[model samples]
Target: MSEYKFLTGLTSGFTPVIDAGFSLEDYRHIDLSVQNEILSQAQLDAPEAFQKYLDNFLLAQGGQIPWGGYNEHRGLYRRSGLFSAATEEDLIRNIHIGLDVWAPVGTGVLAVLDGRIHSFKDNNNFGDYGPTIILEHEFEAGKFYTLYGHLQRESLKDLQAGEKVKQGERIAALGDASENGNYAPHLHFQIIHDLQGKEGDYPGVANRKELEFYLSNCPDPNLLLKMN
Candidate 1:
């Protein structure tokens, strides 16, 4: 399917990451590029330092969500070995495929559309997705999926495969470092055109060589959130 059709219903639809009182006015776009001052100031390798950065950022901006990750080449990944390949020859996955909402731990995460639970798993490794959930949505164009990564462990409790999730329903909560792969609390939201038959997990970052394919498959999540 053409990439344009992948975001057909979602762009003109509702917000998916937060509960209420969320707006573009309440959002501060985050910069992870090498030129960004925020990255230079914060000690990203330390969880506490990163958390302090997030806390101060939100407090100063009065924003509920610090969003922006689609196709962004981030230097912050250097702090985590998980983003590195076993060998130097292999391209590293630093380009973010999803839009992340940095919020307090235990923040409620919602679904943007009606769908069923495609799969859920705890990818419990450092710099991994932690407790993740993939929801399958049936759109007129075709079947696609929405992935919610870095969620609280309790969010997946008693969740059955193929369980129905309605539009705007609470599906999960923001997880902390201990449960969310040791990063600051946030919801890693991505729209996947195809899962490639993978379940429970999919790549949230792309190698530079296959950048085009991953970029096309995972369009800017703001297309769904419409947060300006």
Candidate 2:
């Protein structure tokens, strides 16, 4: 079976990764793409300003969770040399491949499906997923992986490679700007069909050239969550 079909068929209802308090009704899909005119480069360059905008956005919308960004072309990574180190235009990785759930620090991050800890690490970089964890799952004929990024360091404290994580169980907590790669507090969740031998971290964004391959490899996370 195809990876996308395998995933969508595995879940019958919405699967959430963030705190359980907020229902589907509480999630407001916020646009962080290049097309969003209200957001400026300056705001995204600074986590505080971007967070203030998000606060106001949630307030204006009367929501608790602001999520989206799968396959989105974002301008949020331009400020960091992490994504702009490439000299070629097509080599710049600007297309986001994960779903971001924006929330307060310490928000509980749950496991979407029954899986065991494949790997975990503190990928501390200027624009990186600070404390990340990858889980491996297999049911019936399908086998795949899930990545949870921007988590608190404490989440990785007692974690072991083979540690089992039950579905809907609290596995991590959201990290702030200091620990979450200098970004606002959020959970970066992604579905990966193949890790290519990488662990603890994988490319959350892809360049124009590798977009096709990455898109197919990393299926849209909504296939499982069905949040929107």
Clashes of each: 0, 0
Q: Give me the runs in candidate 2 sitting further than 4 Å from their true place.
A: none
Using lDDT as the measure, which candidate wins?
A: 2
Candidate 2 lDDT, 1-228, residue by residue in tens: 264786887778878898888899999999999999999999999999999999999889987899999999999989888998899999998999999999999999999999999999999999999999999999886789999999999999988999999999999999999999999999999999889999899999999999999999999999899897
* Per-residue lDDT of model 1, residues 1-228, tens digit only: 355555755557547576655666778887766567656635677778877776777788786678877888877676667787535533887788888888788888999788999999999988899999999988777788999999999999999999999978999998999999988888899989889989889999877877888988888787778776
* Candidate 1 error regions (>4 Å): 5-8, 11-14
Model 2 steric clash pairs: none
lDDT of 1 at 225: 81
